[model samples]
Target: MPTTNKKKQKKSSDTAVQGTNDSSVVSKVSAASRGYFRDAFLQHFVCKVARRAPLINRGYYVRWRAVDHCVRRFLHITQKCPKKQILSLGAGFDSLYFRLHADGALDGAVVFELDFPDVARRKAALIGSNITLMGMLDACSPPAAGPVSISSSRYRLLGLDVREESQVEDALGAAGLDWTAPTLILSEVVLTYMETQRSDAVIGWAAKLLPQALFVMYEQIHPHDPFGRVMQEHFLKLNSTLHALRQYPDTSAQRHRFLQKGWEQCACLDMNHFYEGLVPEEERARVERLEPFDEHEEWHLKCSHYFILTASRGSLLEQALLAPTAGPICGPHRGPAALGVRPTSACLEGLGMASARVRPDQVLLTGGSSRGGRGAEARALIRAQEGWRSVGVEPSVDLDVRLHHSATPLPGGGVVIYGGRSSPLSPTPGLFKVTFDPCGSPAAPDSERAEAAKVRVEQMVCSGDPPPPRWRHTASVVSHTGRDFLFVFGGKNQSEPALGDGCFLSLDQQLWMKIPVEGAAPVARHSHSACSYQGGVLVFGGLSGGGRPLGDTAVLRPTDGGFCWGRIDVRPPPVPRYSHCAHVVGGKLVVVGGVWTHSDGVPGVVVIDVSTRSSVEFSLDTTAVPWPLMLHSFCSELLDPEEPELLLMGGGGNCFSFGTHMNPRPVTVDLKPALGAGFPSWS
Candidate 1:
């Protein structure tokens, strides 16, 4: 646990800096002059963008590459540090975690993202379920921690405004983290937003809080070059789009202040060297020669606009010196913590406030947590709140019903639920359907609602024969010969001793037939993920009864009368994992978060991509033990039509040491829209 010390500091003024000095100005400034300053003011702060949208495209690639270089270096140091506690101070939706999560980089590192309340809220919404964040947006609200899955754990997003010394201390103290541990501190594109002196005080406080903590930062060195002036002007003009930029270091004198605050001056890497590393080797050589602005421009003299700096906590003398006579530090903001907020434990196990989808213009909900028996039940209970409505298909016979995972809606309107556990009382053979009549409006009349509800199951059934009695399997609807078919593969049957495969229930036939899998078949397994593309079902990763996980990849082609299976040599096999969700975005199948243990014996996510056949891993940066989760459930949605990003949600976490993964918490991830060549096409 983190040690607490009682310390207090007096507050100072937070008055805005005056733009005009007492210069004898006989004439009023013109509108153009006023507009110039306005533009610069707006250009001063953080600009918002979609989380996965490449920062490279936004012209922040230079800063981003610098950040990555610094982090990679720090991670090397952290890899040496026994206790890896990563704190992203004023983390402004930085994609560091995204890249880390993509590669499963932080093993044994407990990452804590700290920011002001408003910023934390936005980060939470955008990074929803992608990385586990720590701090709660509304302390009064229920905990946001979802079920722990085998592959991943929740992260904390602590609301700590750097300006508020007390709140900063409070959040740190509450984290129960060991300050003695070697920590990596990141302040990216943030200090410039704050008064220089305040930034210094924060640095001083951080040094005292964790003397061994290493700092990595990127800040705009005061730009006087024409380019620099334009950049500043650009910010000021788009004030609504951009926030205020506090004092930027114009001379080396300003950079000297950080060292005075107890930072051990480390190496500084420039933007050109950084971005040159990102592009292809051939392009990189060319990129290095390219200038951001014209040579004739004044801004061209401002050394690439921004610089990446690394420092360690030590005597300020080892680094740059502070101003001989530094200004006083300002106190915290006077207003309520922008979005007023206020942390949790084992009730027992691991978590969502509501299970239903919320719509715009919906009324605020105030209710208790309802563990609805099935997905439909959960959705129904949550949708009962005013302003939200539910549309879901319950498994014809319940075993374990997952609302979003097992069931998906067709392009037209009908609903499909496959691979649900069959009831012990009455096992289902396979394949069930419920057709929705949106045209038969529910608001029309009681008769219409009855008629819509009364549609017979047989009428919805297709011509193909039903598959076997298998639960804990995967099924997806793919189009073949201009018709949609529910493709099923590899599931455990209560009756059959081993996992089975290759069954297709034609939406048009309604019958279920066991596909005669030919060629090399994937290993017999259950709980594996299956996705439909073109006229094939791609299967990956699952566990056999022997308890060992399988890493086989196979595709089932729907040709002839039945489906045929073949193993396409995935150049590399993913690490054995189960309960991970798979989604086809663009043409890549993203296999996200699955269970794994650290060298220190802690559980977290181990992600792998078969397209490249590489192992990626991420660990919770905080010490909080996530619920041991596996096999609870998972669901995916193509959130944006244009981008093709996938949103993954809901899975169980393990609460007991029963040695089995069973988390009931919901996890989420909004992946980068897949891009590239040789992608599959769906009919």
Candidate 2:
């Protein structure tokens, strides 16, 4: 690339970075409008107010809460100081100064915000036009002059590029910054947009200039996972790549970067840790109730990818800096010596679909929302000498468009699919039992993608007490006496956040009947895994009513009368997860892929030996699978009745505004490496 072209590219990238300020302010205004936080001045910066999804609202709320927590802590710590300061790098349309002034938190403290010249000028113009914003500003220095866009006694907004160290230093000095004052430097999602070398120079410059400082930063990390990949690609498309993530990919590496630059003490925590450890339980509950949210998988993934960090130099600020937390943290993110597994394609893709093995070489899939949108039709993954291929299945009856339902194979044949929804408004009602063609789906030898199969469906009308319409629940075939029953358990409906109630549908009698269910029930949860164990079923992790993942493994075993529940504790405990699939083969429970919190890596395979009371977790090697192998909202089935192999189909979901990511094809995992020997030797 020529130097002239490089300069133009850099200029264009800088403009795009400035444009981010506009979008960010709009999101902040939306979050404030929804009452996630109190920011009266943010609305003035945006031309219009648009409502964001609850997930995005929560994302911004956590970012706001983390930053506010640090700011308040800094203010409280230096309350007695005659002069203090807060310098926000790449500040852009932020309403921090006015909000602080309105709250009367900045008495002797001064705020200095620096961004690209364009963003600063726009922010200054917005402030000058708003009577409310101008009212909060100091009357001594009216808004706008030169590079110093808005100049006031308590607030100074400078329009200058942050990469130029000498320029910013001289500019801050001219704006009345006390070099020796107790300063809190905030950089929220900034710095990462700059080149890694430039960002490093900026970090070094800040540490070298501010002797008594507490640096607070919020930025992206873990750019290699499925969600992280989508996040990186989103920025790439915008031509503003996250350059810092390549070098500083996690909390530890980020903290190390600041320390290596010049800071003394540093501590970093992902948003998950900050939300769980710092935010009070009552406060979290209050914020959660403000909106209706169903995107738990994406929410957790978003939290895991972004982080909040605090690094300090002076002893006074070091004592008050964010501390590194370990034991007090919540969620299931324990990094262990990993067991690696390889990935292969099964040639089927979608999300929230239910899968069941209807034939030796055929797996029935029904009801999921894909990138092409949700359809009432069903698809089948037909296995041959090659790999599994998906085929369109024509059902005798019209199947309603639904996702996150349960498909359980009956002992006789076919599958009973129950309870799913088109959207979060409510769970869809009714149940259907579909039996596939005996000879397998007919398709051309080479054109599996363009062929159709046949299946018979019937609406099963049941009597007695049917379970409330719910999706993301488990419907398993549990045998009692000589009869097989479709045991329904734990899922959430629109009216309820989580459901713990269980119901039994007798497959023989074709009616919902009462069954003696003994022992203490697990907490209300959704997106759990239940597989047939002995004569009953073993239930695993799920998202609880409190919006946390449950890791406890419980078994409901037959004891001559009915069934009894017993909790099992496996050594070397697997991380708690939900939206995964499980199967029992030869007394061992094979668990594969799901969404988890706090951890940096995506979920893989976790195998538990029921007889030995032991468990092991293995990370997937997705080199061969060209796309990101997101494992949530997906379905998996055993390739063989007795083999320890799983054919996982249709995973991924809307990745929290980044975009929708669907596993382009089904993936197969050979559990033999994890269960029998150990991880396979790639070498």
Q: Give the best candidate by lDDT.
A: 2
Model 1: per-residue Cα lDDT over 1-683, one tens digit each: 32332121111111111111000010011111222111111111223212211112223434444556556655665675566677787665544554464456676666677765655665555544432332212122333332111112324566556778777777665664577777778876566656556777887887778877777776655343223344555444433111223343332444465677766665443342233323345443333233221111111112245556667764421332111122221111111111110001102111111121122111111111224332223222111223223233232343243221255455565455554432322234434444433233423443333234321122244565456666556767766567776776676554543366666676666666554556776877765778776577778777654323456677777776656777654433345556556666544566654422101212223333445543333332222324332322444344453554333233442111111122332333323322322222222
Estimate the TM-score of every prediction: 0.37, 0.95
**lDDT score, candidate 2:** 0.83
lDDT of 2 by residue, 1-683 (tens): 99999999999999888878877888888899999999988888888899988888999999999999999999998998899999999998888988998899997999999998888878878888888888787754754455788788888999899998888888899888999999999999999999999999988988898899999999999999888898999999998899999999998899889999999989898888788778887888889788767788988899999999999988678575465343543333222444443454455668888888877777888988867565535887776656666777778887788888998898898889899888888677788998887353334462543343568899998888787898889999999898899999999888787999888899877889888879998889999999988888999999998778777899988878888888887766678889888988887788888888846477787777776677767777777677878989988878775566677788888887788888877777766666673421121
lDDT of each: 0.44, 0.83
- Model 2 worst lDDT run, 10 consecutive residues: 329-338
